[model samples]
Target: MKKLSPEILEKLKGIKAVVFDVDGVLTDGKITYDNKGMEFKSFNVKDGQIIKHLRKNNILTGVITGRDSRVVRNRCEELKIDFHHHGIEDKFNVFFKEMSRRNIAADQVAYIGDDINDLPVLRIVGLSATPADGHYKVKEEVDLVLSSEGGKGAVRELADLILEATGTYDLILKKQ
Candidate 1:
């Protein structure tokens, strides 16, 4: 993980929720089609592992993606994400609605997106981030450019930062 500046850490401390864009942010932006026409995507267990801790600490989690797939749905379900929306064309609108419904302010959320489609929501979040392999345009817009690539440890990296900034990292560890 790259070093987070004091300013970034301060911003992260206010984050009450974390939202993600699926393709490049969580799965390396790769989609596999089997001969049987089944779709598959690889997700990092390390990323999944930290979600429960976040929830335990009262930090909400969610997924908003343009594409829809059973694989992605299953993963979100398994992780017990607070919100999951798929096949969304206007990501910002959906994100805004969800946050509004939950009474969460834009400045209380962090978003990680890897492509242009994710720009609208990313720009409004309290802290925005991208994977190391994210598109150049996206990397430029985000507050943090994570060292790990998508489907590797990008989400975990961000999760770690959030946990630490919120002063819950040691609390989670104490249970282990």
Candidate 2:
């Protein structure tokens, strides 16, 4: 992980929720379909574990993606992430609505995105992050760009950073 500046750490330390984009942020930005029209998406096991850890520690987490898929829904269900909003034309609307419904302020949210469509919510969130292989513009706009590419532990890296910033990573590790 890169050394985070004091300002960035301060922002991350305050994040109570973490939202993600699906296509690029959760997967490798690839969409595969069989001749029968069944779609397949690959996810990182490490990332899934980190998400579970975040939930265990009482940090809110969810997904907001432009595309909808049963695979994503199944994954979120397995992770027990109830705040996901998929197949939305306007991601910012879902972000805002979900946050408002949960009574979470913008400054307490961290949004991880990887494309142009993610820019709106990323811009307004407290800590905006992207994968190393994210879109050029998205990378340029993010506060933290992980060394790991999407679907290859990027979310795990972010989860570790967030836990570390809030002084919970070590505690969690000790307990485990």
TM-score of each candidate structure, all chains considered together: 0.97, 0.97
Residues 31-55, candidate 1: write the lDDT tens digits.
9999999998999999999877888
RMSD of each: 1.0, 1.0
Candidate 1 achieves a global lDDT of 0.92
lDDT of 2 by residue, 110-164 (tens): 9999999999998999999999899999989989988989999999999999999
Clashing pairs in 1: none
Query: Could you tell me the lDDT of residue 163 within candidate 1?
Result: 92
Write down the worst ten-residue block by lDDT for model 2.
1-10
Report the number of clashing residue pairs per model.
0, 0
